[model samples]
Target: MTDVPFTRTETPVLEPITMINAFTVPVEESERFLRRWKSNAEIMAGKPGFVRARLHQSLINGAELRYVNVAHWESGAQLEEAQKDPEWYANTLQMLNDPELHIQARPSIYEVVVEVEPGARLLP
Candidate 1:
């Protein structure tokens, strides 16, 4: 096969902020936690810099961590702004103060180094 030269197009890269939250919830209270979590997600989705949010549940029958939340924001400042909102604060406090659910959240922020798209060629 002969190599053909193709013009490469470069698009602006986005350095969006990412938040990962690991949650350990009691098996029996998983549904209730999901409901509350969804409501919280909706509130975040309405924020200015919010990109998207996803919640993942462990498929293992007896895993230590029950759920993991991954959310994307335009920047860390935007995430902080969302957290400062009254509704967001209230919902967070409610989740933290709830006794029946026994929910624990371990949250952290991250920055992307590189991203590859399917069917896209990498140019040197």
Candidate 2:
């Protein structure tokens, strides 16, 4: 994906929605889980409407979820359509269905209701 300039100076269009996914995985299974997730992420990164994505790992070892993924898309429809590709779907399903890797995923979509721009507003 081309790097888009981060120079917009507007109220920030809310066209691109966000997808948040949390993953619960045991420490021992983290390697396997991450490998599968990486594969899936690479495929998704090449899809249309895929603006950007980041995966964050908890600093605390005992955090409930090991990883949280935040992805931005032009729209939910486009994101959904991107994942519907036959090959992508099959690959994703294979990872999900793997018995050895019991990864739990909680995914949700959200629209931006508020935002704090950098150095844009004075401290309250």
Best by TM-score: 2
| Root-mean-square deviation (CA) per prediction | 14.5, 9.7
- Where does candidate 2 stray beyond 4 Å? 1-14, 118-124
Tell me how candidate 1 scores on lDDT.
0.76
Give the per-residue lDDT digits (tens) of candidate 2, residues 91-119: 67777677887676777778888787877
Q: After superposition, how far is residue 29 of candidate 1 from its true place, in Å?
A: 0.8
Quote each prediction's TM-score: 0.78, 0.79
Local accuracy of candidate 1 as per-residue lDDT tens digits, 1-124 = 0122211122123457788888888899988888889888888999988999989999984777889999988877778767777887677667666666777777778777778899877786
Q: Name the weakest run of 10 consecutive residues (lDDT summed) in model 2.
A: 1-10
Worst 10 residues of 1 by lDDT: 1-10
Clashes of 2: 0
